[model samples]
Target chain A: MSPRDPSPGAVGLGRRRFLKTATAAGISMALAPLRSAYGQAGAPGDAINVALVGLGAQGRVLMDAMLKIPGVRFVAVCDIWPYARTYGQRYLKKNGFEVRAYENHQDMLEKERDVHAVIVASPDFWHAPITNDCLRAGHHVYCEKMMSNTIEGARSMVRTMKETGKLLQIGHQRRSNPRYLVARNRLLGEAHLLGRITAVNGQWNRAVSADLGWPNHTAMTPELLQRYGFADMHQFRNWRWFKKYGGGPLSDLGAHQIDIFNWFLDTTPSTVIGSGGRDYYEGHEWLDNAMVIYEYRLPDGMARAFYQVQTTTSAGGGYFEQFMGTEGTLRMSENPKYTTINREAAAPPWDPWVSRHFLAPQKAPAKSDDDSSGGSEKVDARETAELAGYYLPVILTKAIHQPHLENFFNAVRGKGALNCPADEAFKSEMAVFKAIEAVESRSLVTCQPSDFTA
Target chain B: MTESTNTQSDCGPTLGVLLLRAWLGVRAVLTGIEKFSDTRTLQVPLLDAAGKPDSSGAVVEVTQKFYSLHSYHAIPDSMKDKFAQEPLLPSLLTTSYYAVLGWALIALGIAVLLGLWTRASLFLMGLLYVSLTVGLILIKQDAGVAWLAIHVALIAVALSLCRHNRFTLTRS
Candidate 1:
């Protein structure tokens, strides 16, 4: 067979089958409002002490978000890069926090006993190990998603979290965003906007971009690169493109959106079929574009969701997900600009929904197909029915990452439940890995219940 | 000879109407899909289910910036704050107007081609064009004002002719 053909025969028979052992699916949020927790980290006025591991791009973003949360305080920062280490310390000191700096995470863990929690923003390869170490050291961990590059690594984190009894919240930040909480919990879960959701579709199309560059002032020595399994500075900075260090673009990008598929459906996929190629970017280990379909068996019938991420062009639009059902479709992006609930023609009148606070009572769409009124001509009802879609407001004004971090800190203090906890995050990991497998294999991969179990 | 003569005479307009219907039908369907698929209307930085925009939405952001960049160039220096916001309210209003207009054109063309309620389709096409003309004239922009008037005139003529058409899905 040609190397171009992608077909996964079995999990243990080949590397594709080996992926079957990987962990995680679904984002079953414990529906409870958070109470202020974590006064124990400091006095009533003092912020809870937190340390950060992996001073990469996501690490920096998380640090900024952590600073914004009222109760959390950055106490230590660690990275393999000497410049990054000092940069973290300097940045924190500039912000009035006396942060301890460490070139190694183990050193940070051993030294910073006062830290109440740790945020693991390491590359995909290191997520499990670093998060596990932090949990072992008695600090709650908020690790970034796609739990690890490997399902085994992801599963190990879940096992470690379970063993330690520490709060291990995975960084699927959408779980924490209030607008999504309203969309998912209030609208879908409570009100059932998209009644009996039968299908889902989503895409994340990014414009062409150059290879990522590292910000460290000094390049890593060949020995250091060898130690970290990187070929050079480029590989270190762009670890996401590598097979060993990252889950490529599929696990990196698709993990976020597919988790929503699992979130809205409240079920792990039974099968995933995908097709993709590295057509756009050359010399990358990961595919540049991947399209995957996941089959989720609902109680009444089978529902399907299609997810695609293309790095070559942003021709059509930005990333958004739509849940379609018998009644209506609820589509939302991060911005309020695209969030809306569109009713189907056969769906019930939406005005009653307004009283339920699910929809904003706007004009009942003056341009309906029903009445030619006194003198004007009437349009067809079906076409005008599409116009009756309602837009939601920009209700959540806080930056996106803040709420998840807040939830993690709150969970650490025993005040709130973890939204994207290890068990839930792992389902997404399994689903993501399965999709990546299907794309590479060029075959329909059936997911057994065993596939989701670690 | 009589049957053959009658058949030849009837075939001409029937084929013409069918051909015309296909042309208008395909054009309307494709344009409707285009409107539904337009990048600006799609809205994003495709966020995570958790509502994070890490994946997409840069196109909208860049376009918004471009709008602001142009407005900053054209507007008075005294109103720099208002101008800096870019894609001002007028532009937003114009976008909404065009979105609705795209849908109506699509609906009008499809209904007319399919002969689905001829009177309503022709009237709607005319109403849409007239509304668009008024909106464009209100904006006072030279860019597409002339085209809007042409559309209005063409729709007006089509509406008048539609009054006498015998071929339709539903007869008056």
Candidate 2:
């Protein structure tokens, strides 16, 4: 007798298969709108293809961070340095990723048709060419900071992205940091908390020196060196010290603080006046200590922002922002602590009973003026003033980097607008550019939007 | 029999000779353009307070002019500087020579691509390459000089490959 034909459920196979298939189909249907909204969303459970062009310090850190996110696969990597290529490949392989690698970016762009996005962390000189090629090849991009070494390169990059209708997210991580977001919100949203902010001060100080003996050698060949505006290996490796490859401290460190200043003021500075030079460090082409004063005119009035960055000295504590106002002052930083201090009262107290009793109260026989009532009044005033003088608010935030990454991925999926778009980056770049100009010219430099245009 | 033999042996112009002439012609035209183009008059944004163009704007204007002449596209207005600084005649002449050389090169590139004036165009392009390369090197504009070097090398290779004036005005 044929074994009684097992029922579908009893067979433990047909029903389960049907359920699995149904679930997948349902998910695809549910995610259809999301896929349409976001420009590109890979299939469910499919790895998203990505490539990293630069494997420098920051580039490696970004790769580690991207690996933490699910559904990502590093498909290809490119760097002019052979070591960077092998390093990236080994890291990916150790993490179970099968990545093809290329020494040249053009070749990678040509070969990697399935690549959905690319992360560019190459030197400033290569940013424009790599980014333009990536966009033209129809891939989204996450480029590292200081979009390009030159304004022309930056303009060309922006133009290429616009023409190609591609997405580019600059590597300004503070825009993604939750602590900075909280501080930004408090400064802009709580109008009276810091009174009317009339001035701001920002400082970023470090203890780097030319004598530190850091590897200041570049690996470019003589031919390449001549072609790319580098005088030599030292100039290329320590590009931050030169005007050709970088904007020095103003572009390196000042960019972050300047962005914060713009965030707080809700407006860009109309003009920037700057002074300071390479007073401390020797053998460096860029300024070791510099200060820039930016005057931002808001709808209410004008405000001043002073930025001081020093690389030689270690004496540093004000590594934050101080907002000054008529009524109080607010000091804040990314450390999650915000403090405010109210102004002291300008007038002294007067006795109320003297007017009612007589023009002047006759001296009471032997009773002192410092009685309990007067003393209590003084104590109360003191307590009130003390309470009003300072308020410290500590904000608690979960990691913001993950959320920022999530936002970028979501934007790729068409879920939201970019937190920091190219236009905003252009503004930030312009501010930094003007700061450098001011330092170079030794005078005030006005920043118009047109200054950044091609 | 002797007369017929002589007529049969008579050799007209060889392909090598024809190619050399075509190359020379292309070179002359490119050199003329390089000598005649008015690049200094080009305008650019980022003018200094005194109304003179800033360094960045000036460099961009010059580069754009060079590329425009190379690609045969019209120069855009944003590049026009209102404050006309005094012309550097020597520099202007050098720039015009490069411009004409660019057109000539483009014409040669087309001729070579079409196999029309292959040998002559290749030769002319090669000569233009040498002059431009020398000028760029002397000017000490490192970036421009590097690119010019590459172009010169490429033109040299193309010129060497012309067999029998395969494409030349003579052949056309």
Candidate 3:
């Protein structure tokens, strides 16, 4: 049948209408608040006073994204390092923003009373404290992910937000990515194109790299390092690999993609088994490579997802999540090139979706040499046609983190709901926390459903 | 055998030349035609669960291929962007070249097919291939350069056997 033809049956027609309605609803629901948030031109009363708490690498990234958003003004910048403080202050000033700089977040809060929202881009160890303090100080917060270095710390941030009745958004930016939203909500959730998903695999691998270095002239004094909970500048700069400051690669990289497993499945893992080692880099306290397997007990049937984060080599197809089912598979990544959907030969035809322009079929495979040469060859009875892939017809042209930050800002303005609220991210973080535990104990860690609750 | 049949069989080189002319002419014409093609999305009414067109005004986007002046200009403008930064290529020259490239390909392709000034058409086609090779080489596109080289080679063979040309737009 031609692509424009409606499906032959009532059920198919029902699905088509439902797909259209749901897609339209989802787009309006997602776009309406964002449009309101972005349309404001920073007029006097509409402007939101904002503060940045950490001016390091992640802090600079968040600052750049927030700068593009409308109706937000930076009033203060804070960081323990004078080097970063200078960078953030200068960068913002160049963008027509002049803000006070401080070496401490509390000091900034005390001086900048009008600040409406604070962005916590500090290290994992400091995320909870900074976010909690900002919330208690009557300011909404947008904190970077791996919510906190510890489960108790993550829970405290959630509890504090509840007590203060403030907005707390976690930086799982993929949660707000339009491409991901369409794939998860429309294709998988509404269309049910991937049939019964039974298995998943994901990875984030990196090539070996040397530790970060700092300018000798900008180095902090020993006394300053001691007060800020760092052994030295090395510990402060390379905090992600240390035990006291971070949860290693699993929390640093795995948290982003693993959170999607929970979000897409709408359930936390029941058990986590892990294996890892800190073998590559010397003086680093955390594992260099970690592999984890999480088992989910859904209402229908059990499913499993395997995840890994390796800092030694980027050999395995960059980073992406693959969901395999009887009908099809979805390979998703923040990188658009790594994302696609493939349908099994046994699955029903997807002409309706193609007709609706929801999915675009890729080029068909060339005929095999045996068939082309007209040679008589017996085909194996078990052989099936190759799975054909379709490209998701969506793309994100802006900075990857911009949408999530916009979502946070909109929530702060009471115009929209937080995409990655503290409570929801806390649940996903529990899986990573347990996977880390499984790594330490070298055993499978079983988690009760209650374990995910903050 | 009949005299007409003998005449046809004796001119094997003419048949070879005809085959090459047809292949090149069709390829060029089709490539030019595709430059005018583009995909446009339109919202169409959706069918409800009962397989009847919905009255709720709900619609889904349907993309269809269209031929228009906008696509013809846009395709060349896109190619100009790719060639913009090549040190050996000037922006003005690239722009002018692209403006006429599609039409020139179609006209030349037809002239060769109809044996209208076949010698001049084949020579200009070869020159076009040569210019494309230079552009591809400057952009460090090895595969495109190789493909253009093969086209130039075919044109060279066709020109060498123009003596066997039997068809023309006017009497010989």
Q: Model 1 — TM-score against the truth?
A: 0.65
Better of 1 and 3 by lDDT: 3
Q: After superposition, how far is residue A11 of candidate 1 from its true place, in Å?
A: 30
Clashing pairs in 3: none
Considering just the first chain, candidate 2 attains a TM-score of 0.75
Ranking by TM-score: 3, 1, 2
Q: Give me candidate 3's interface root-mean-square deviation.
A: 7.1
TM-score top scorer:
3
Q: Which residues of candidate 2, in runs, are more than 4 Å off?
A: A1-47, A190-192, A210-231, A337-402, A449-454, B1-172
Span of 10 residues, lowest total lDDT, candidate 2 chain A: A1-10
DockQ agreement of candidate 1 with the native complex: 0.02
DockQ order of candidates, top first? 3, 1, 2
DockQ-better candidate, 2 vs 3: 3
lDDT of each: 0.70, 0.62, 0.81
> What C-alpha lDDT does candidate 1 achieve relative to the native structure?
0.70
Q: Would candidate 2 be rated incorrect, acceptable, medium or high by CAPRI criteria?
A: incorrect
